[model samples]
Target: MFSKSKINDPVTGKETDAPRPSAPQAPASSGAPAPKGSDFKASAPKVKPPASTLSADLHVTGNMKTTGDIQVEGTVEGDIRAHLLTIGESATIKGEVIADDVVINGRIVGRVRGLKVRLTSTARVEGDIIHKTIAIESGAHFEGSVQRQDDPLNPGAKNPPSPKANPGS
Candidate 1:
C-alpha cells in the first residue's frame, strides 16, 4: 500500500488524505515541468473578520491599535487606533482616538480623529474633534471644537484643504 497523509485546505474547507504519488517520472522536454505530487490549489478571496469587543468588565491601561473593527464596552486609559471604533453607552475612553469611522455613544475625554465621526444622543465628548465629516445628535453633550480636514487620522500630517463631495452628488 502507498503512503497517505491528511492536508487541511482552506480554499476547499476540507481535510483530504490522498495516496502519495509514485516514484519520479522521467523529466519532460518542456520549458516548465509538471510537479511530482498533487500541487494544484485554489486561492480564495479574504473575508472580513468580526469586530473585536472589550466587555464592560475589562479595563485596559495601555494603547490599543488594530486594522480591524472594535466595539468597546469597557474603560480605556490610553490612545486607540482602529479602522472602525464603536463606543458603547457604558464605555469611557481617556485618550486620543484615531479611526476611519467613529461612532460614539458613551464618553470620551480626549481628541477624536476620524474620516467620519458620529456623536449619538448618549455621547459625551470633552475634547476637540478633527474629522472629514461629522454628525452630532440633538441630545449629545459635547464640550469641544470641531475641525474638518481631508485626512484627520494622520496625527503628524499637516493636512491641507481637500475637496469634499457635495451632498447632492
Candidate 2:
C-alpha cells in the first residue's frame, strides 16, 4: 500500500503521486530562514552625511561659494563668495559681495568688496563700498562710497563723491 510518484490533475482530468521537497521557507522576516554564514561583518557601514554649515537662518537658492564661515539670516538672490561674511538681523542681500570679513546687520542691494567692513545700526546699504576698514554705526542707512582700500599706491588719492554729485555735495 505505497502509491506515490505520478500526480496529474489538469483541472480534474485527475492523476496524483509525487510530492516531497521538505517545504519550509518562511523566516527571513516572515518568509523565513536564511542566515548561518552571510559573512555578517558585525553591522556598521552605512554612512552618508556631509553638507551642513550654512547657519544664520539660511534661505539661499543659487550661486554661493564658500571657503569657510558664512552667516546670513535668510534671503539671498545670487552671487556671494565667502571667507567670512555675517549679515544677520534678518539679512537680505540681492547679489555681489566678495568677502574677507564683512558684517552688516541687514539689507544690501549689491556690490561690497570687503577686507573689513562693519555697518551696524540696523544697516541698510544700496551698493558700492570697497573697504579696507569701515564702521558706520549711527543709525546706518548708507548709500555707498567709503573707499580707503589700503592705498594701492594712491589710486586717485581718497577723494570719493562724484559718481554724479551729492555725497554731502
Candidate 3:
C-alpha cells in the first residue's frame, strides 16, 4: 500500500508530503475545473416563490384605491375605495370603506358608506354605516341608523325598518 506521506493532489498535480484538505480553492478565472460535489451546493440557484395571479389581492401597507371588485381577508389599516367590496370573515379593517356594493362579514372600526350594503351574521361594525339599501340577518348586530336615499326626496314618507342594535348593550 502507498504510504500516507506520499499523497497526490489532483488539482496541483504534485505529490505532497502532508495530507491536504478535501477540496481546493481555485482562482475564479482559472481554467481549472471545480469538484463535482463541492460546487453544486455552493453555486445552486435560489428557488423563488410563485407570483400571484388573482384579480384583486390587497396587501396594502398604505392607502389603497381600486375601481374593480375586491375581497379583503387580510388586515387593512388604510381607506378602501372600490366598486364592489367584500370583507371576508377573517378581515379586519380600521379605516373608511367606500363602495357601490358592500358586503361585510368581518370586523370594521370605521364608517362604511355605500349605495347597497349587506352585513352578514359574523359582521361586527363599531362605526356608523350610511347606505341607500341595507340588509341584516337574525344574529347581526349594528349600532347605527338606516336612512334610505329615497327618504331625502320624499321626506314625509314612513321610515323603513331600522337595524337592530347590539343585544347585550
- Candidate that would win on TM-score: 1
Mark the regions of model 1 whose C-alpha exceeds 4 Å error after superposition.
1-42, 161-169
**lDDT tens digits, residue span 1-169, model 2:** 2333223233433322222212221222334343788654444587744433455566786778867667788888887877778887788988877777788999989878777888899989898888778788999898866666663123344645555776554
What is the Å distance of residue 91 in model 3 from its true position?
0.4
> Model 3, range 133-156, lDDT digits (tens) per residue?
888866776775666663322224
> Between prediction 1 and prediction 3, which has the larger lDDT?
1
- Candidate 1, TM-score vs. the true structure? 0.71
Q: Rate the local accuracy (lDDT) of all candidates.
A: 0.87, 0.71, 0.69
Between candidates 1 and 2, name the one with more favorable lDDT.
Answer: 1
Superposed by TM-score, candidate 2 places the C-alpha of residue 5 at a distance from the truth, in angstroms, of 56
Order the candidate numbers by TM-score, best to worst: 1, 3, 2
| TM of each candidate vs. truth | 0.71, 0.23, 0.53
Ranking by lDDT: 1, 2, 3
Candidate 3 C-alpha error for residue 22, in Å: 64
How many Å off is the CA of 114 in candidate 1?
Answer: 0.0
Q: lDDT for model 2, on a 0 to 1 scale?
A: 0.71
